[model samples]
Target: GDSVTQTEGLVTLTEGLPVMLNCTYQTIYSNPFLFWYVHYLNESPRLLLKSSTDNKRTEHQGFHATLHKSSSSFHLQKSSAQLSDSALYYCALSDRTGNTRKLIFGLGTTLQVQP
Candidate 1:
């Protein structure tokens, strides 16, 4: 019963504010690939950040996060939120070894930014 969890389903905020979407996960496997994907309405989910090795943080496209097996979490954080950054975000993890193609996705966190 391994899975990923995103606590926030909807986040509404004004422009120029900070935003943090909580992400906690659990997996029986020792090695897991934590990922963050951004989907801009009608667009496909794209890779944002991925943890290649534990404790080594990964970041891309103005977003950053690290997979911590000790805490069993990979939370996304950003200093200032932008109106254009508003979109549906997902915290995902790909299964280990032979199941690399399989991804466990959270329900998804929707962010709404107002100018």
Candidate 2:
């Protein structure tokens, strides 16, 4: 079965620093859309970045991630990560051109920024 895996379900942080969350996936499909969704306190998860083009990275807001079919990975990263970055980050996927199923997700990483 195709599935997404994210390393470290939680990450602790300082007021101003960098945060990197590992995201890997396994699927037989060659073309799958990878996405990063950010869920703030009370708000629903919102799209951060998404892409199906291999090696071509996708970025949104201040976050960036890329899809690597060869590595079967799409790790999210940011420079000088902020306190406001404290929230939930979910790595997701939507399969091939013919598949219309809803997206699937990794458990998510809860970023705790300490002021």
Candidate 3:
């Protein structure tokens, strides 16, 4: 079975500060795709970053994440946290079984950026 973990349930940060959302995963498959999805208020969840290749960093929408096979981690990071960045962040894992693929999501972390 594959699983993802987001250690923090809520993270509060000041605007202009660095942001880092811890994400780690465990999967029986050798190669797993990790993703970060952001869900803003009243909006559907959207993909922020995704990576299947280990040790490669992926970035989108001012956020970035790197998939590390050795540590089984895909932490999302941003150099600066903005008010607009406040949202619910989800860490997900995708693995294939036979011809079907399944996505597993973590408990999710809420980012609250203060002005």
Candidate 4:
């Protein structure tokens, strides 16, 4: 079985500080698309970054995450954090091992950015 893991439960950061959210995954398939989904206060969870290319970085909304197949990691990072960056981030893995694509999501991480 495939699974995604987010070790951090809550992440707090101040404005202008860098941000990092730990993420790791395991899968039975050789290639899998890893994704970062952001969920704001009331907004629907939307895909922020996604990539299947190992060692390549994917970025969106001022955030970036690189998928490292060798280490089985895709940690999300931001150079600087903003007040608007406060939200819940979910690390997800998607692969088509059967007839449909199955997505395994990690436990959500709550990020609070203080001014």
Residue 2 of model 2 has an lDDT of 78
**How well does model 2 score by local distance difference test?**
0.84
So what's the TM-score on candidate 4? 0.93
Model 3: lDDT of residue 67? 91
| lDDT (Cα atoms) of all candidates against the true structure | 0.83, 0.84, 0.89, 0.90
Q: Return the TM-score for candidate 3, rounded to 2 decimals.
A: 0.93
* Best of the two (2, 3) by lDDT: 3
Task: Indicate the residue-level lDDT of 51 in model 1.
Answer: 75
Query: Compared with the true structure, what per-residue lDDT tens digits does model 1 show for residues 48-112?
Result: 87876777777776677877889988988777889888999999977668944588998899998
Candidate 2 lDDT by residue in tens digits, 33-93:
8888889988989988887489997777778888888888999988767888888999887
**lDDT tens digits, residues 1-115, model 3?**
6788896788999999999999999898877888899999899999888885778778887889899998999999999999999999999988754566578999999999999
Return the TM-score for each candidate structure. Answer: 0.91, 0.90, 0.93, 0.93
Q: Model 1: C-alpha RMSD to truth? A: 1.4
Candidate 4 clash figure, as a count: 0
Report the error of model 1 at residue 2, Å: 1.5
Each candidate: RMSD:
1.4, 1.5, 1.4, 1.4
Stretch of 10 with least lDDT, candidate 3 = 94-103
